[model samples]
Target: MSLNKAVMLLKIIFILTAATSIQGKVYHPSYIDEASTFASSSEYDYIVIGGGTAGCPLAATLSQKYKVLLLERGGSPYGNPNVTQMQNFHISLMDTSPDSPSQPFVSTDGVINARARVLGGGTCINAGFYSRASPSFVKSVGWQEDFVNDSYRWIERQIVHCPNLAPWQAAVRDGLLMAGVSPFNGYTYDHVYGTKVGGTIFDKSGYRSTAADLLSAANHTNLRVLLRATVLKIRFDQSGSRPKAVGVLFKDENGNHHLASLNVGEGKSQVIISAGAIGSPQLLMLSGIGPKSHLKAKKVPVVLHNKFVGKGMADNPLNSIFIPTKKQVKQSLIQIVGITKYGSYIEASSGFSQSSKSISYHHGIMSAEAGQLATIPPKERSFEAISSYIEKKVKKKIPIEAFRGGFILSKIAGPNSKGHLKLIDTNIDNNPEVTFNYFSDPFDLHRCVKGIETIAKMVHTSHLLNLTNDDDYSMKMLLNISVDANINFIPKHFNDTSSLEQFCKDTVITIWHYHGGCQVGKVVDSDYKLLGVDGAMVVDGSTFLKSPGTNPQATVLMMGRYVGVKILRERLGSEAGV
Candidate 1:
């Protein structure tokens, strides 16, 4: 070989070695020192507590211009194989209960539903079902026209919500449509905001993309996300006339106390709380920002005394009506579509096949004939009323055929329920008591009962009858229509004659759509700035003024973006002297 060629080969080898070393230096969970602790006085430009739905996006966006610190109560999900895989979402559900201390996820009073506790927050463990809030509901929250319009466009660009065409979702969709459950085809983009015709599924990529995706892209050295760092209390500056949120006092998994504060002016710092509905309110109460009466009971010194801090607690009550299928579904049809279309795009990096195969069936019942129920006084609403309403709705909706063939009825408890989150104990680690008082409002119960009856009619319709009949030889017979077939079948399961008033009493659980505790117009202003506090802001589901009549993820994300933009504009304007 020529001498020149040999010299060139050595130089190429050196360059390759250098690149490999740099790549290996990338930060991973294992590299973070678990034992290494941060000081109580250590400060940053922005301290975002609770790295869930709102926190992640807020941190990701603000980090672009400021030095941000994200604090989460849960541990790092990075190396955990269960969090990374898509199918593991269901598996992680079992680990998400409030009682499951080992897991970071919590439920109301320690019960588990669908919330997550990892780095990406709930998006990491949620079913990845993306739906926008109804525009009507958005307007009710005092969002101006321009803000709403820009939010819609910004969210679309940030998180991609293509349809889920997976085989599993496809099968579910086909089964639903074939059975007369029509697809909601109207106004797909803003369907979640107000009225929805058909259920929208999660986009493919196998897994739903979360704030982790965006955060990963930013990868700035000035920004840091500390997981398993639960905020115990908000430290206030005593020198201020009105207490200012100077820092956060948090505890690690090992139960060691640490504090993260702001270095304002010189560094210009602020604290954004996005710990979720339950977590955010609880944190405020612990820090002495809630009702004076409640804090007096807890014996915590009151700082702000906002009576509305945890007052307007609200959640959608969901009742499910299960209908047995005649044919054995081998796999969910939507899953197949998601796998093929979304999977293909992920692998080949081409085409419009961006949706996944998760199927959702949503049915809305709005009646001009039906008048809105009278609003129940907050003190008068009770659990009994809530349950009774659900039962009444189910009975009215049951079809004669459904009476013959068993069909499960799922109803969303109306938006009038009055509930609150109160501190059961002074311990920050202890879960707060969440009084859902689900069926408290008579009107809420009435609407739910009406909704059930509506669903029953749809189930008994011809479209459903044809799909459920045992025409296929391989399928099991769900309903028997032979002359000698038991007539009691109709009366037994779908007994319309009998009062289903007991149904709600039997089964009424929160739809997991808890909101309005630290409500807009009440606890915080429209901009999400706490009315009484200077440096504190509540930007999670708790800030929702009213229930959006659907899942709250999209709206929550929009709120995060809105808050981020507002903060940036204010800070940047000050800096630029505009």
Candidate 2:
């Protein structure tokens, strides 16, 4: 062959390789990009606001059919090694501060909770606990069978949810069980969710698993993830009565605003809000799609008067009782459990094997009187009621003095009290007023009291008692002594345990599980489409009508996948060629 011809062929091959690699490249925009460049561009079929949880998956799925653009207000998640490692994610929370680009939203009320402002969204900074929705929750929301079935299949295929227990997690679970705490079945069936006597733990696969998994799986061509890009507003076509979301207005790190209009047919464009409970509602309110009164008060014109935009906020209140362990367990036990349950994945990728050791146990009070549980008003349900209910249930389940070892009781679904996320000021950049109004409901207060009492009972149980040494047991004995004793034992360590109600109020902390605000039916339909808004939807936990009974990450992913399929099917038709 001629030398000239060979050179030409080589050049063609080189160009092809480069193009393919560029298509596969993951875009990680920083805070330094010139905003003017993004503002001038006018290309994209679908613009997904908030590149966290739901947005990431939506981008990957829609990209299969059309050009998709994902706008994240935060920076790239790749630089943080702690985010990649599972065990490190928890500790990484300590590093999250007001200054971090990965967390753009901050609680005005000082509370330490991590929200990932990175490309993967909250998934980049979560505990990596993969729990499915409770059956009762699914049925309550009226999710069609087809939708529910598709969600399960999509999750199993996209997100690996089998137990990834590390050795440390296993040891913890075993120790807890050996000390008489039973594991609840983790799976759910119908209105019944399964709980086991043993706690479930995930392996050492890194903490952040959202974009790393879905984007890797879909392998789409037209999808682009733009980090450090915050959407400032949604532009609507002014000519129409029911305004159409024609484009989105976004700002890069330089504070420059860019507008990208919808390019339909090339791909029908729509905005999917997966910016999490706080961000999604904030964005909606910023764009004039919130409570009319609040919007007007802030001098922002109202486009949609959705009173429920940020009203039904909910989160799990965790009250931990630290039980002193007899043995100094190495943290490596976390890795061991992961290898045991997900050995194949660990061996194949070396990702799961090195995963962290995070153990979570689930135990709750089941009302024996059935409908009697619903007697309290939903909004009026306080932590006290929740605590009382727990006590009643525990008294029925086991003897109050059955537990004697050192252990902690973590309670989810503490209260049913509602909270609101209102605009703090006219400035869209400022965070909203987030009041959990935690423990405001009577049921919530009762449940907390009961939860504490139940924990105390477990501490006195035989199994727990056997694990405690004589000295520790004697100390407990002294606290229980009567006033008739010659020397009154005012045990300093036991002062915190004097009363169940007091113990609950002092020890209970937010479990970092927030949801329900902008809930389904009230704000949006079951499919997550806004009740009155066209060309927009809320796809985060904000749309959850009622808080599910476990970690919500898996359920959130399922909702995203479910919504993605519905949108795709509607747009492309069931038989349309991909």
lDDT of 2 by residue, 222-293 (tens): 766665677888876656667667778887777777786677554346777788877778888888888899
Instruction: Kindly report the root-mean-square deviation of model 2 from the true structure over all alpha carbons.
Output: 14.4
Off by over 4 Å in 2: 1-39, 96-112, 161-194, 197-208, 264-268, 332-409, 460-498, 576-578
Local accuracy of candidate 1 as per-residue lDDT tens digits, 238-326: 67677777888877767787777787675346788888877888889888888999999999998878888877777665543433444
Error of 1 at 561 (Å): 1.5
lDDT for model 1 comes to 0.53
Q: Per-residue error at 215 for model 1, in Å? A: 1.6
